[model samples]
Target: MPCRKERDERRSYGGGNQAQQYYQQSQGAGGQKPPPQAPPPQNGAGMEGKFDDVKPKFNDVIFALLFLAQLGAFIAISVISLRALPASEGSVGLGQSGGTATTLNASTAWLLAIISGTALVLSILLLVLVRLFTKIILELCLLLAVAMSIGYAVYMWVERYWSGAIIFTIFAVISILAYPGMRRRIPFSKALLLFVIRVAKFHPSVYVIALIGTTLTAAYSAYWAISVVAIYQKWSPNAEGASTSGGTPSSGAVIGLMVFAVFNLYYTTQFLTNLFLTTEAGIFGAFYYGGRDAKKVAWGAFKRASTYSFGSIAFGSLLVALLDLLRAFFQILQSYESGQGDIIGAAVACVAQCCVGCIAWAVEYLNRYAYIEISLYGKAYIPAAKDTWNLLRDRGITALINDCLVGNIWTFGSYAVGGLSSLFAFVTVKASNPSYIQGNSGLVACITFYAFAIGFFICHSLGYAGLSSGVSTVFVALAHDPEVLAERDPQLFETIRRTYPHVLNPV
Candidate 1:
């Protein structure tokens, strides 16, 4: 927490003196400031046409190298696993097809690709729709979330889960009560969302980047899935005589390989997702800070994200990936314990998993804001994260409203996209009735579930990477320099002021 004076200084946002004070305060102990950067736009200035050269220095290069090394190791393992697959190209129980057990094969991989591709298209389409009907989607998602919360609370209470029931009931009640106050912020949220959309319309590369990310994610998902299957086939203890060396892979070795492989998958996927988001944030941050050249800024940001700031993005991704790995581990432990009927052990694992999951969520949430700073200033991850923490504290109300209202829009929008994609996959698979899964309702359902999971994550990465980056950039920019918005676009400033009158000051 800040001292009272610091807090007061942060809260008082209007006027040149206050702004200067806040800026100076941000410089901290040594009074050092960020490098000279883009100038604010003039009133009514458009964000189109040529862009200028703006280069940034490399930050957190070590982490970028580490990520590359990790990728190399994973690739080596994948290659080995692929080679081993031919020896044990057999299948265990998956599902029955034509009265025989279905097996993993090239056809299975192709089907997975098709399903994931369907999700890719559906995710992109739904993202567009969400941009168009932001308010409606937001409202509907909120209603659904609230209803689910209440229903879950009731179920938990009936099941005699006192802690879960109490927690969820509180969440439900608070949501219901907060809705009235939150409702007023909807217009402001909509306006901000539209502003980002308008900027994206000017820069089509925004969507292009998202497309690249979604494609890479989908492709990687297929590759990882196949690699996992190959590992299991080659290394399973049951594959005694099938191994190329005529020796079975020990159970411990199999587990180790799988664990590392899964960790690499999580880490690589996370790095790609954050890379997309940081790049998007760089573009938006450049625009927000009044870079005259939209094209140059967009490309420049992209270059920096993939080069100079790559390590910082990797560093952030590593943290989240590690947490995710831990959470997964705990979940597995919980499942094992529950299956063993060790109630106390299962509860402990459950709590640990929940704690780790929450921490992971918080880290990722912080990274969203931190990436704005990183994208704009090229600061290393630690400093960027610290700056974001202060920004949240100083602008708590705006952050809250943005998270509660605007954030939920992208989140629930992704869910909607995933659901649609899952339906599309189910219908397509049923209609085609492919040989690998013919007459296998269980197999079809399994495919549908994978589709939903992949669709949800890919949509989240793609959708959130672009629009949500815009939102966070806007928030950070406004907090850093509202005067720019006020001077450059007085009309927008006043419109925001109407709903968030204290935006000029502090809410």
Candidate 2:
């Protein structure tokens, strides 16, 4: 427990400086910080286009080499998995028709299964070790996750609709180049030494983050799978639709499965994502503001996560879930369109996919940073989200995110790495199968991808979430009281500058 003197000091962090002035004002009215807008829009204004206060440093390379490893893992895995996928009706699972299962020799089937199963096990163990022991290795894995996520996004974009891809590609370029206060990109290997220092200094918080995120992910995934399966059987008149045998399934069965699958994934993912993310932030908050006792800090994080941020976390999760459902629904439509020739489905799918490029990225970005503030102040969701956005804008964190892709990069890598790793298993299975099952490889690959992806994602979240929160906490702490960071951990305070040159003294 912190001594009385420390408690008195922490109280001061709540207020008593220029930084807290805005923070104080934000908390009053749902934490809304109105951008400086001139009243007359016709002549002079709307929202501020650029950050007025923040000046961020460029050339941040916190996890560059790690990102490359992630990229290679994803690419190699994806290429190998591609061979497991048969060129014919094997594509039917998500969009295509269900035909014959791919024939694979017993040995081949065993090989693929063993390969994927091993990858899954190793990935989990690797993530755990990275979190608890090897900080650099953990980051490398995290960056791999980010690379995968980005790859998946790209694949989704160009896979179904070329036109959509072309148009969005233009928008993406414009968004990147035109965004104000943007900085130059860093080397893929930038800032390893600096990031290593940061990680070492805060590994205790990282450990708690890893454990909490992993537990929540496992719990949610199990709950989602069991409930979704039961719901599938409940809605389907015949339970045989549960089996992927060559039998035809009613559209209703597929729809039931799809609806539940989409919503529940989003629901569970959002909830766990928020819950763990908030915990990650709180853990960092305890350490950055108060000195660390891993268990006590973790407990404090738990209280705030369950009690204070409960409402916001639930509601915010719903929004992300719905948005994801929208994205997934479009993909499903596109899948069925080729064979069904449902022009209406095609049209609607096209419309649905129009915003695919931006919406997912934006929603993800908001959920992540918003949770940090939500955990920090014990504020409600909307206020916390608004305050977080305002703080990012005011502090140049948004620019850092947009230009640097510092925090969210690992998520993309994790998604891709899992897919690629699944692919690796898929190829190995095909080579081992004497009969060479055609379609089954894709199914196995998909399983491997999801299993590895989900677990790896949660693991990477441990690293990424804490690090991002650390940045946010430091920014807020500095703003509220510049000396707080310097006084509490002067080494960390200086290290922050090396990591982000744009940071200004709050005083």
Assess every candidate by TM-score.
Answer: 0.76, 0.59
Candidate 2's C-alpha runs over 4 A off are 1-205, 222-254, 292-295, 340-348, 354-357, 402-409, 412-416, 424-456, 466-468, 488-507
Model 1 lDDT per residue over 192-284, tens place:
777777778767778888879878988898788777766765667665123655346778877998898888988999989888888888667
> lDDT of each model, Cα atoms only?
0.68, 0.48
- Find the candidate with the highest lDDT and give its number: 1
Off by over 4 Å in 1: 1-55, 84-108, 131-184, 239-242, 245-248, 291-293, 397-404, 422-449, 495-507
| Residue 504 in candidate 1, Cα distance off native in Å | 4.9
Say which candidate scores most in TM-score: 1
Q: Enumerate clash totals for all models, in the order shown.
A: 1, 37
- Candidate 1: Cα lDDT at 163: 68
Could you give candidate 2's per-residue lDDT for residues 51-157 as a string of tens digits?
Answer: 23222121112222333343354334324322322332232222223543332222232333344344334445554544354325434544454344445447547
